[model samples]
Target: MKNLARTARWLLTLAWQADRARLLKAIVLLTLGYLATPGIALALGAFTDNLLDGRLGATFVIGVLIALVLVAELMMGHFAHLYYYEVGELAESRINSELIRYVNGTPGVEHLDNAKFADTVTLVREEIQKARAYIEALLQVVLLGGQLILTTVILASLEPWLLLLPLGALPPVIMGRYAQRSIDRSRDAAVEQNRLARHLLHVATSSSSAKEARILGAEAALKRRHERSWREATAKLWRGQLAGAALRALGQVTFAAAVCATVYLVLLQAVRGLVTVGDVVLVITLAVQVNAQVAAALSVLSTLHAAGHTLRRLDSLKTWPTREPRTPAAVRPVPARLRHGIRLEAVSFSYPGSDRPVLREVDLDLPAGRTVALVGENGAGKSTLVKLLCGLYEPTAGRILVDGVDLREMPPEEWRSAISTLFQDFARLEFTLRENVGVGDLARMGNDDVLTDVLGRAGAEPIVRRVPGGLDGALGHGYTDGAELSGGQWQTLGLARSALRDQPLMLVLDEPAAALDAAAEHATFEQYAGSAGEVGSNGGVTLFVSHRFSTVRMADRIVVLEGGRVAEIGDHAELLASRGLYADLFELQARSYS
Candidate 1:
């Protein structure tokens, strides 16, 4: 009951904010609708009594009362449905907005990356609509319970033996509670399976894996796996429901027998001259309504139980902590510019729940006015190091400092604004060209002059020109007037977006041009190099991560990573002179072209 109250209070508050006027109106209409059932029953009984007495005036009066009650019931029922649905939709829309805002703006990338969090989000998305129906569900409970109460009182006035009809409701109430617990457990199991099934569906249908699956003839296997997962998830739920249905049937039979017995006693009273014909009709009519109201109340309680699961999931989302302690031990603001530069002192990191550290005891320095490049084999932790620099993930051991201040001191958004990055697997958003580029800095997204400059700097100008609408053209092939950009084209657009950051203190470009042709790649690097040199020659740092020696050679310094440790750090000339791992990798790459 405590849990139920909490869920009810939460939904009521959400609905009240969604539309105050509509929700209040719905409550009034609910009362009117429930009143109709007993009103019609009583009016009919009185009208029947008048007809039997053969009094023309009394019969006419009772006839008018019955007609008025029926018409009012119908009108109340119609408007109640309209208001209830409208308010429900409004509540749903408001929740969707909140959900999106929380998911996107919530600090730290862990919630977005972790599997459990992802599954929770999926369940919330699926079941949030159930919460939107809370107002109607609550009203149904009260309306039905009130009908049962009023029916019991009316029947008791006719004959006290009719009070026995309401007592049979206890058995159904107990059964409903049992069914609710079983259903909640089943839903928990199903949510886990649903996440797995959705993953399989994505693998089967996603464009990235479609070709590979078809080539390997793995589509059949994927379909079978999906079916198996769904079966496992839903099997227990279905069995429990079937058992619940049987129990419900048994309970209803018991109540029906009770109803019949009550009417039999009432009829016996009329035959004994203890009551009139109208009294028998009222007792019988109210007895059936009591049974229906009991069933309706039970149903509403069960519905609320199911919705409680979704409400709990939504509540969990709000309180889920990010990777960092949300509140800082000592909060400090980041400066607009760095003077002594960023330092990583004995930093190490591992993914959440993993034993193997991706970066082990790494030490590095990015002094304010230099272009540094990181060269490493796959899995050497170059990307992980970059994430640390960007504060995407915190170090498992050691600490990072920026000009003597702890990296954790700075707010994430402020730190993010100070740096521009182009990750290897950057998102290809299907927005208009202007919107895509504008995302780099929303404040300046509409600045046409800046947009044109960034595009030109990233070598994305020609790509934009190829489309008929230029920067106004929609990206992606799925929508009308949307052009499917080539791999290099998309890469350059990502570059353009990264470059949109104005006078950022740090620039990190990870594999800046993997898809471009050799000539285009070299041209972009040289152009970007020139731009980065100007930015970093001041109190700014530019870092690049790539296997391309041509681009790495342009950096003022190169750091070679091997086995998650810095194997060597020097300029191109100095590293080649030492003929260590950097020289070996550079030479190997140089031989590939020859």
Candidate 2:
């Protein structure tokens, strides 16, 4: 109950914040319409009595007045719908914006890929239009109740027994509530299935997956799986619909019987001369309209219940499980300069939902103004270590320290602001070349001189000379006449983007030259190392990962990682003299070159 109240409060607040004027206009018009409904039956009765009494003038006036009332009702209804549409559009925009901000703002990318979160978001989005009118739904129910009351009063005035209209209307509302519960249960399962089916269809059709799918001859298999998913999902929903139909049929039978009983009782009253012919006509008209009004009011409840499922989803979005936010006590002011250096003491980590650790206990120090290279075969935890340094993930067992303070004592945002990174899977953003390079460091993004120097350092000068628009050309095939680069060219642009941050405290390059030829790779890494070492007194530490031993030899120190442990750490000559894993790997590469 408390949760429902909280959700209602949230939706009400969201609606008011989105647009108040339009909301007020719609509700007022709708109320007036509801207030005018019972009056129409009264007007009809008045017209009948005047004619029966042989007062033709009175009859004519009432007839004209009835026509005017109907026209007024029609006008109010028209304006109400118009205002609802406007309010709906604005509310959808506001809701989507807020949802995106909160979801993306949560620390890290884990929850973004969570299936439950995806399902909830998709369902809420599908019902987005109805969800926006939460406050209006409450107001509608109240106004509908008012219409029912006014309708009951008329039926009672003719004969006290006519109040049975409400009782007869009760069964349909009860049955509808049952149907909605079944639908809600079925809908949850259906939504999950639908998402999976849609994903299969996308994988089969999307260009990114086409090569692999065709190579594996899985196109027909994918189609069959999608069809099965669709059939299963729809089948459950169809059963719910079947149940609802059954309920509606039972309700309709009771409704028809109520109408027959009301007619019989009114005729008996007329034979006894207890009520006039006008009163009989009024009772019959009020009964039908009143029944319709009850159904309308109940239908609002059914709609609200349907929308309530989506409202719950919206609430879940706000409560998604996430990494704990840094507490005030845990945050310490970062120093203006790197003091002793950054150290990882007994650090170990495991990804979420995994039992095995990716990185084991290991101690390493990156002194100020030094270049450190990390080299390891696949799954040796080199990239994981870099992720830890970049604050993308925290160690599960031990912690890292900056100078002498715990790294956690500084805020993650502060830590990130002082560093730049180029990951192996660097994003090929579908933007202009300038935007792609400048996006790495937004503060200096507009400075063309900074972009030029960074591009030179990244060996992207050749790419610039090849393109007609130079830095201004659109950088991907997704845009009109966009310039698509070779893999090496894309790597060059990525390196330039990372280098745009003029003086980050730390620079991490994870295979930054993976696609470059041997000579180009050597030149890029030399520039990266030399430039990082020139930061003077507060020079940042540069860390890079590479499989090429020739390039790795350029680092001031090389750390060889093996099976999630640092197996050897020394300069190129020292590690070679030690005759360990690093020496063997280096010798193997040298032989290939010879």
Candidate 3:
């Protein structure tokens, strides 16, 4: 009974925010149909008694009335079910779609990286279906509750002594509901644990870590850890289900005993000459009807118990603030070149949860058509700076300006649309050859000539030539007959994908290729240098990051970053002559190659 109360409270609260008119109309229709159930049952029972008394005329009249009531009940019930279903679907879809939009439009990428936010993502995916089911179940409970009250009231009037029947059965119901409370909490916790366990298992089994796991013989250890989590979750789930079932059985037994006692009481009343045999018949019929109604109500209660837990999970989404649609701002077009240069002045930034800043008091300027390469060892704040330039991250305490306009005030999306980027770990979309390159320019995606042209420019023509189906060839690791490209080949295709974008003003290639041979790497650099300064009717200022000195040498200038600041900025020979950090790193790489 406690669980029922809790579920009822949740249902009322959830519906309170919905369209009240629709909810009220649905309830009224359901109540009318429910109210007619006992009258139909009583009239039929009276008709039986009347027939036994040779009152054919009264029996016939009651039979016709019962027929009319049945038709009305059926019509009302059908339309009520439709309204409830539609309302539940609308609530679920609207709530979930809004949550999705908010997540997608959130300002920073770090929102997805937070553990608690990740947990919410998992919960939302799992609970959307459950929440919809809960709403439907809630309506069922409402309908059944109305039926129970109406039937119980009629049964009490028919035989006043039978009032104790339902009341006597209440204790076991209360116990069952208490058991449900524990079960619901445990079930929710188990689901969360299972999600984390599954994520761990996926990471452990990935091909990227497979070789290391095999050499270290960590497979057995990983399997054992997975098994431990599985066992813990399953144990909790089974315990909850078993306890709930036991309590439910106890309730059923109590209800059965009441039915037996009520029958005996009616028979005794008939024998005492206080009631007719027909009256006793009516009491017995009404008792059976009441039991059926109560059973149905209990069934609805059980469903709500399970659904209530799921609804609570979804209610968390309602608390999340809604996202307003982004109104497109008036954005100035990119200049033919970075004439006045791009500038980051007094820039300061830190990662989502870190106390220490990744970039501090940093300043940079890249003039028109100049290739600026950033050189840094791993974790020297290279990628963070790239994200800042790409508009993926905003400075915590500074300004980025393009032609003296603060980038923060300018439309970030417009700036992003004007740049092409190839990250160190670029995605390999599982699609056809055309789509692989065409995604760069969505407007020209299916243009065969444009795709071919970009493939040639990015040096991915060799891959296209080798595939059996040419531009139509399937590519991915997932397909059975899928042709997987070598690391160098994949890098070339990624570059081609970037090149397919129609005339972006700035290009970013972060560690574009670290897998190619020395000669191929040199050739790639030559292609990059040649692409700058309005080359081949296409134009862009290229900003690249590379660990290889051979690749860095092709840039018009190099900026050496140390301790979150630019330590040196000059052309290759100029920096080499200075014998600073760049010269030292260049010597180290050159000697290693020798």
Winning candidate number (TM-score): 1
* Candidate 3: tens digits of C-alpha lDDT, residues 300-353: 666687656555545554444432334557344545545566888988888766
| Predicted candidate 1 versus true structure: per-residue lDDT over 426-472, tens digit per residue | 87878999998899999998899999999988878787888668788
Give candidate 1 misplaced runs (Cα > 4 Å): 55-68, 101-105, 243-254, 323-329, 466-469, 477-481, 535-538, 577-579
Candidate 1 lDDT at 310 equals 70
Relative to the unseen true structure, what is the Cα RMSD of model 1? 2.9
Model 1 TM = 0.90
The residue-by-residue lDDT of candidate 2 on 40-109, one tens digit each, is 8888888999999999999999999889889988898789878866776787888788678767776466
TM-score of each: 0.90, 0.85, 0.74
Task: Give each model's clash number.
Answer: 0, 0, 0
Q: Which residue window of length 10 is worst by lDDT in model 3?
A: 317-326
Error of 3 at 101 (Å): 1.9
- State the number of backbone clashes in model 2: 0
Candidate 1 global CA lDDT score? 0.81
Model 3 TM-score? 0.74
Greater TM-score among 1 and 3 belongs to 1
lDDT of each: 0.81, 0.82, 0.75
